[model samples]
Structure formats: structure tokens, C-alpha cells
Target: MSLDTSLLPNNIFSLKNDEFFQIIKSLVGEGLCEILKIQSINSAENLIATDDIFDVFKYDSEELIDIKNKHFFKLQNGQYLVKTGIKNSLLYILKLLKVKKEEQESLLNNNNHEEQLDTKFIINHPLLRSLVSYYKYTDHIKNNNDDKRSFLKIFIDNIANNLSQSNNHFRYHDSVKQFAAVLYILGGKNPGEQKTGKKTS
Candidate 1:
């Protein structure tokens, strides 16, 4: 008997900006990306939980070959976009990460498991809120280690700079602000800043 792969579950994808932002914020808020393990990506059962939530990325049947090649998987047109195999793998990884973070948080009461934050400073700043949300929600979905590290550096720099510029109350003076000192490091171009303009040489 031949196995029918089409009978399997498909995890969905969404491309809407609002939905994208919502997913991004939720992942950052959950804090799973900071501690998720690579091995969890292989968990099969985790793949099933995302079946309904993953179908947001639909495809054009006219471009079936190109879509399959670009997405690195195959799927039938009109099938809920989430149930395809490659998407299933991605969802499995995300679901496993989400569950793992929840487990970690539950173990933290009266324990030193949670990372310490300076409480005297303003915690309700908009950027800070965004950062915390991003940190928590992206915990499960950010799978690239290098990308995560880049994100962490950018996140820290952005938060520190915002706090410093908002008011003089928070102090990090005398300490070198290599990344935060210049706007260029964070990829912003100042009015008088020179632009070399992407020359490979």
C-alpha cells in the first residue's frame, strides 16, 4: 500500500503586515527564542498542533512550479497552505520552542532561573515594551543562531539609546557606547554622514 502524504497535516503561513506584526510581537513576548534548542526541530507531534494556524500563505496555481521551488516544498492548490511537509517541519520547531519556554518559566518561582533586570529604571517605555514583546515572542520562531545574536545586539543597543536620549535620569555615562554612540551602527544615516553607497570593492 502506498502512503498518501496529502492526507498529512499542513501548517499555514500568513503574509499580511498586521498579522505579521502580531505574530512577531507574540513570539517576542513569549521569550522562547532565547532558549529554544535545535534538536526540538525534529519533533513530529509538535508539527500537528499548528495545522489550523499555519494555512495563511496561499499559492497561485499558475505559478505552482516556481512556488514549489521557492518555498522548498510541494503542495496542492486549494489545500490549506499550512499542511505541506516543509511548513510542517517549521511549525514543529516553533511549537516545540514555545512549549519549552513555558516549561522554563514555570520553574522560575523562588528560583534564580529568570534573568535579572534593573528595576529602578523606567520599565514602561514604548521601545522597552516592544523589545520585551519581541524577545518573548521571537523566542520560538527565530531559528538562526547568528541572526538571533544580531537581534540581541541590536535590541540592547536600541533600548539603551532610547533610554539615554529620552531623559538624563538613567545613567550609563563614562562607559563606551560603541554600538549606540553612532546612529550608523544601527543602520541610520545622519544628515552630514557620508554614504559610500554599497560598493563591493
Candidate 2:
């Protein structure tokens, strides 16, 4: 489904720019991309428990337990819903790049590092390549940097493109746009659209 844009929060971009980057950094640093890859394989809407998550990402059992306690996974009808959001979408892109959380964190920390982000993994990741190509086409108005793109732009474009391609009944471009609206609100930017005033069906 296409997003109306008018159905999103007005203050979705309220976060400071640095805070936005920090959120992105934390998501990448904590292996969120790997988690998202697993989720994508299994189906995003499928209710999965901690055991399921552990099997995919191999995160420490203790940490998984803590995440459960934090209500990251919502309980509905005795089933735990997998967490879904922009962060998960961004991580999925990173997973396609074969970028480890450590590597992403290191890059975030040292913006001036001469090392280049390896795109070799993209050769084997057709879907990721497609999504990245789509993102660059739709999001970039002008080419300022050489071959590199910012993590934020990549994240947004990937999510937008992925949502555009989703065939699932519950997954739609509008949902992804709403997610972007939330990010903008958190980042202290004034989102253009107003709330839908109606609950999501």
C-alpha cells in the first residue's frame, strides 16, 4: 500500500541530529542487522520467542533474556511478536553488506578513517544491490561524495525501497513511511504530514 504521508506524526523529526546517528550506531553495533536478516528469512510478522531469536543471531542467552524482560518483543495471545521498525530495516541492509556490528561501530567512530567500506559482499547479494541501487536513484538528488554514502541515507533508502516491494498483506509502503516519520520526529525535524487520526487496521 502506498503511504498517504498525511497519516504520520507531525513532530516525527524532533530528535537532534547526533541522537539520530547514535540510534543508528547502536542498532548496527548490537548486531541488529543480523537479527533482521534472520527475521526476514523467517517472516517479519511471525511470532517468535527468545529461543527463536537466539537460534538466528546467536546472541548471549542472558542478553536475550534481558531483551525479553525489556518488552522488546510484544506479547499477544501468548505469542511474542518480533520487533519491527526502521532500525531492523537498516540492519537488514548492513547484513546484506556482510558488515559486522564491530565494523559498523568502528566506522561510525572514525569517520575520517581512510579505509573504504567493502562492497565486495554486494556481488553475492542481488536483492541488497537492487535495494541500494533503488535508494541511490530515489534519494540522492546530487552526488556530493565520491563512491561513499552516509549510513543514514542508506538506511532510509533501503527501508523505503524494501517497503515498496513488500507483498505481504500487513507490510506496506505506508507503514515504512510512518516509520520514517517517527525517525524524523525523533531527530527534531518537523515532519510534513499530520497523523491519520484513525488507527491502523
Candidate 3:
């Protein structure tokens, strides 16, 4: 159970061990505390870079995964909305109090387990995915029937077809991106590389 956010007391000494964990949990639940290890990131930071996205999942902590689903953490835009005062207040308490020896041993053991699960850090970032998908499309096209059209032309044509399929119902501004996504298919560099992926809506 979490500590009631409204009923917080000022004195850390007054809280029990479980209550301490509860406060920490309230500040940043589950494995999110491990995020502090990555370049000493604090919970209050507003933006998370693409490269650092993997670090957030580096440990594959089930706790991290659980809390990540909370609406405040918008992984889609690489924005994490941590609660106010988390860094200067309760998080400082974590540093102030020494962990029990048994808990320390348990954490070390968990770290070893986390180290073995490398798949957690594999990012679903845009550039990597675009490269992968583009290459796969090229490989498939190359292996099958010959086509004279260039890769850029082929993908651009595909984009055009998709746009026309909806009778150009997509808004003019959004259609701009729908058309632009073809350049990623044809190996364009960093056209708003980190976020927007819209097949529809």
C-alpha cells in the first residue's frame, strides 16, 4: 500500500521502515529509483532523451515497467512528469538513511539478475525502427519481382496512395508528415526523429 499523499508528516524520523519505503514508493514507485543511476538523473527532470530511454529500462525492473504505465510518464514523447518536491525532499531522505544490511544484500542479488536480462534496453525508438522496417521492405522487394522504380519513388508513391485512400481527409498539416514519413523509408536523416508515428489519427 502507498502512503497517503495528503497526510504526510514533516519528520522522517517519525516514520517506520515500511513507511519510509512507502514514501519512496509514493515519490517514485517500483524500479524508477534505479533511473537515478543513469547520469544521476533526478525524478523531477521534465525531459528524457532518446539515448537515455534505454537506461530507464536498463535493469528490466518489473517495478519500473509497472510505474511507467502511469499517465504522468509519457514514454511516447520522452517526457516524464514526476511529482513536485520528489528530488529535494523525500528522495534526499533516501540518501540520508542507510539501508538495512539484509536489504542491501537483496538489492545486490537483484542487480545481478537485472544484468542478465539485456533485452530490456533494446529501444523501440523511431530511427532504429525506421531503419529496420525500411531495410526489411527493401530486402523483400529485392528478392521478389524486379521493379524499375527507385526506392524513394516507390515509397513516395506508397505514401501518396495511402493519402489518397482516405480522400485526403487527413488535415493538411498532418498530411505533411504522412507524406514526409516516406523519406524515412528512403533513408532521410532525423526528420523529427524521436516521436511522431501515425498510421492513422
lDDT for each candidate structure? 0.43, 0.46, 0.47
Which candidate should be chosen as best, given lDDT against the real structure? 3
78 Cα displacement, candidate 1 (Å): 6.4
lDDT of 1 by residue, 51-78 (tens): 5332323444543434334443344643
| Cα-based TM-score, every candidate | 0.22, 0.20, 0.19
Candidate 2, residue 200: Cα displacement in angstroms equals 97
For all candidates, the clash counts are: 28, 12, 0
Lowest-sum lDDT 10-residue window in model 1: 30-39
Per-residue error for 91 in candidate 2, Å, reads: 5.2
Q: Is candidate 1 or candidate 3 better by lDDT?
A: 3
Candidate number of the best TM-score: 1
Clashing pairs in 3: none
Candidate 3 lDDT over residue span 9-114, tens digit each: 3444355445544554565564444344332443222112223333454344556654544423555655555434433443443333323323445878999878
lDDT of 1: 0.43
- Candidate 2, residues 1-201, lDDT tens digits: the string is 232333222322342344433443443444443443334422222222223443432333553554444324645644444456534644453343233334545766676443333365665789879867866774666653433544445555566566767456333345456767889789865576446543344
Q: Give the TM-score (vs. native) of candidate 3.
A: 0.19
